[model samples]
Target chain A: MDTIIIDERIDVGAVFKKNIIKPRWFVWKGRKYAITEVTYTWEDTQGAARVMHFALSDGNTLFEVSLNLTSLEWRLEKSSVV
Target chain B: MTRTILLIDMNAFFASVEQAMNPALRGKPIIVCGRGRTVVTTASYEARVFGVKTGMNLYQAKQACPQVIAVEGDMSRYIDASHNIQRIAREFTDQVEMFSIDECFLDVSKTCRNEVDPQNIARAIKHTIREKLGVTCSIGIGPNKVVAKIASKMQKPDGLIEIREKDIPVLFALMAVQKLQGVGVGRHISEKLMSMGITTAGQLGNTPLEKLMHHFGIMGYRLKRIGEGKDDSPVDSSGGNELIKSVGHSHTFPRDTRDISIIRSYMMMLTEKVGLRLREYGLMGKTVYCTIRFGDFTSWGAQQGLKEHIRQNREIFFVAEQILARAFPLSKAVRLVGLSISDLKPRDTQQFLLKEMEKDTTLAEAVDDINKKYGVFTIKASSVILSEKFGIRPSCGMVSKQALKIKV
Candidate 1:
């Protein structure tokens, strides 16, 4: 599978319950993807900012998304077709 | 009571994590490595079937498995997964020793006394791990760490084997001497044992202690007992999990360079990172060591003693910089730079008597607070600007350097 890099900012729909941030759906390129499952999550450093990466599956596709906790921004890092 | 140690070794940890995250890669060949690194850090079982292996250069891995997909390793992902696995293992026994990021030894001796069967425990642990984490482990159960480690290798991917006390003689009779990994029977030691006509574990155990002692000195006595599949080493519950003997950081350059300025810049950056961690751990050190590995891979290093223990980044950098310069006048291009501090102790609680020193410490603490709230390196020293321009980022993988050297 070819991973197309998409280091682009996007709006995300998330639920904040009991201090847990869970993404329910995200709109990218005007297409809303309903996340079927959150497969994995991990964090890494980006300069001075802490980056939280989420591997989310949309039924048939896997998308890599990141949140910049410092700037409170969301990004679509890359995506692969399953 | 005989102890029962279970060695739970994950199967192709990094690659399995990758497969679990991306269903597309499931049941397919994959190799995990850094983006720029040419060597493969891990190869999935699918790739292993085609002769792909860890430490193989990318080209060689490609040759072995043309369809092998290369995935960049994310240290955070693997570390988090390892922690989760440890949590799961603790559900069965509290005496869990993390042998490595992908392996651990569980001392279920007490659990067994409660009439719990070791095999059932292993099976339950394996099932929970697969169901919850989507990864598998091979578990070896035995009377000691040595036999348990060897037993774990009998089956792979998802395997469990128990080596009972009664089975020792027959099982070890034909077993090669080198298979006893916990005893440190490397090529050097095993070759000597083979030369002495001790080809199998049984013969090694049968060898007279005096003769073995004369050949191997004090190590011979321990080797003979290990040959009989015996080891008394406990599965330490804490296992020095919180111990930070020394704080250090190292970076391998993209290309070897003889530029002194670039070398010092990197040293300063690494030193700052080390100091940040030392402060985080509330540690102070009185010794600094600098190491440089030339392009040829030969290494040179020297340690300097500090007049007083300190956690300030600049103070450690000056010592580390001087150590690096002492090797200088540049005999060769340097490929790697490493900085470490030893003689560590907790920072004193007393306030600094001098106003200047007090101000500096307070300022550093404030910077740390901001960085902790915002991000790392948010208030980095100006000396690291060159490194930043060179795209030297604070990486997650730096912790793995300290993690790998831990003894099982």
Candidate 2:
């Protein structure tokens, strides 16, 4: 699979349950999409910044979203079709 | 009272995990490597079918299969999957030993009853791992750890094989001598054996012990026993209880450099990583070792003993720099640098030092706490800031709990 790096900032709607953050909805490039599932989650460190990475789907396409905890900013890192 | 050991080996673990996570990547040839590194770390079976092998550079792999998908590896995800796989093995038997990130040995002799067969246990493990982790493993069941390891390699992707003691002779007769575990005879030794007209496991096993010993020393006897499929090593399950020998970190520069400032910054970065691990494990060492490899691939190593044990970054780097100074006035530019600490003892609670030393200790502990809570390099030494700016970090090696975890 080919990966296209898109470091664009986006809006995310998340929920805090039992000390865990779950993304429920997101708007990317002016298109709002409802998240059907969060397949996997992981953490990575770039220098001092901690990034929370999520692999989620919107019923048709899969996307990788990264949240920089230090700045509280979200970026769509990459995406693929189901 | 024969014991049964099962060895589970994951096939193309890094590439397999990437395929499992991405539905679009399944059933396609893939290679896993670091972002800028040329060496291939893992290749899926699809890529292997096209004659691509590990350690091949990207250019060579492309020549073998031009359409191969190359994915930059994520070590954290692989580590998480390894922990989960070990947990699944423990469900079958408490005697589970993690041999590496993608391999484990489980002692099932005690767990199996008259109604339960060892093969059934292996099947259960394979099924559960596939269902829960989305990975496949090949399992080998034998009378000992060595035979079990060999059995695991007899097939790939998803294979299950059992080698009984009574069948060792027949099975080994058809196998290559080098296929035996722990018997990595290099080209020279193999040529010598061939001159003696001995080429397979059966010929080696049938050779007289005195003649083999006269040529190869004690290792010859060990090889003879291995050729006969007899190994007494037990599957050790004392992971948490195992003693800590040494903690170290090493990095190879993308390009060889003669710049003293760049070399010193990299040294400090590695020392910080080593010190953090030592403190996290509640251990301190009195000896610090430094290794330097030159551009021509010639290497030098030296160690120095300290008056007191140390588990702080500055102290470790200070001792390491002292050793480096003795080896300096370089004959050639440096290619790689490594730092390790050994001769360890548990941390002492009593603090008997000057005010400045005590203050430094407190400051180091505070920085460690913050980095553990947030992420690595969050609070590093000012001298090592250049390392962060240049994105210098430790190269990946064998997987260990201490190497993977930032916090307990």
Candidate 3:
């Protein structure tokens, strides 16, 4: 698997129920991909912004998406370009 | 009542976390390593079968296991998983002591008194971890900490052993002396005992205390206790926070370099890290310590004492830089550099004496708040960035956390 860094902002459809973030789908580069499974979830910070990261897979490929809480922005940080 | 201590040792922690997340590399031989570090941090059981071991460089690992897959480890992932596991363990017993990133000790004597079996707790922990986190842990339960830690390692991947108080003698008789690490016995001490025909824990325990003391001095008494599986150490939930003698950070160069600019940049970077940690812990120190290791690994270090306690990175770096410039051998290419502070005391909560002092404190606090919410290095000095440009990022090489603590 080859990893490609793609720090691009995207639109994510997610559920925030009881402090849990489950990303259902995201639109990146004009293509909407339904998240088949959330492989990994972790958290980080940028300055004062809490960022939640999720490694989402749409069956064949995996993409790491991060959401900055302060700005409420979703970004595609990187992807396992298979 | 005898304490029931359980040591939960995660099996191949970093590699296991990677496998848990990806799933594709579940059964394959894999070695988890950090970027720019050739040393393997953790190797999977499949890799261990091929003789691959932690700390082995990539070349040596490939030589041992040609098919081993190399994965760059993410510390945040492991830390998060560890936190979750610790949270789970606390559900059973409040006396959970985090031993390391992948290991912990639980004093279940109180919990067990409630009629809950230690084995059931261990089994439940194992089941919950495997089901929720996709990893397994080996748990060893004994009357004390030492035996519990040793027993945990007896089985791999997913194993549990409960050593009763009466089982010490029989168990020690069969166990090798070399197997005991960080349990009151040093390697050279073990070797010395072995030369005296003491090849097992039983033999070591049976050796005359007077004779052992005559040879090893004060440490001999501790060694004897370890040999008999007699450890009374409590499961300290403080997690060594109260035991921190100093907050320090060090980095080794990828290659030895005598460049003044690079050295200074790295020193400033290290000082920043130490200073940040000190402030985070609400600590102030009156002395600055700096060390330099040459190309041949011979080290030289010196400490500078300040008039007043300081926690600011700039102030600490100022002293650290002078100590390095005045003492370090300029002719020698530097392989590693370290910066630390001693004579630590809690930071004063009093109001600043001067307006400038208050301004500086406010600025520092604001920056810290911003970084805490955002991420580390979000607002760092330009010199720190220079260290990165020079290719000397923090946690640079084989200087593991355990290795760093050894020197201090």
Output the number of the DockQ-best candidate. 3
Worst 10 residues of 1 chain B by lDDT: B399-408
Question: How many Å off is the CA of B79 in candidate 2?
Answer: 0.2
> B375-397, model 1: which lDDT tens digit per residue?
66778888777766654623533
True lDDT of residue B242, candidate 3: 52
**Model 3 C-alpha lDDT per residue in residues B1-408, reported as the tens digit of each score:** 788999999999889988777655779998987655567889999999999998798999999998888876766677677777888788888888877778889999988888889999999999998888889999999999999988898898799999888999999998889888666677887888889888999888888889889999988888888888898888877545454577777787766788888899989878767877788889999988998888776889999888999988878888988898885458788878988898999999999789998888888888777767666677788877777876754234232223212111
Clashing pairs in 1: A48-B375
Q: Cα miss at B282, model 2 (Å)?
A: 2.3
Question: In terms of TM-score, which candidate is strongest?
Answer: 3
TM-score of each: 0.87, 0.84, 0.89
Per-residue CA lDDT of model 2 for B1-408, tens digit only, reads 888999999989999888887766789998987655566889999999999999798899999999988887778778777777888888888888878888889999887655679999999999998987788999999998878988999889899999998999998888876675343455677678778888877888899999889999997887677778888877777754578899988876666777777788989988988998899889999999999888777899999998989998888999999998987788789868899999999998888568887898899889988988777778888878865565553344446644332231
Off by over 4 Å in 3: B239-243, B252-258, B291-302, B305-308, B326-336, B349-362, B391-408
Q: Candidate 3's C-alpha lDDT? A: 0.82
- Candidates 2 and 3, the one with greater TM-score: 3
CA lDDT, candidate 2, residue B318 = 92
| DockQ of every predicted complex | 0.42, 0.32, 0.53
- Tens-place lDDT per residue, model 1, A1-82, is 4567799999999987996789989999899999989887766656567788889999888999999988989999988773
Candidate 2 docking: what grade?
Answer: acceptable
RMSD of 3: 4.0
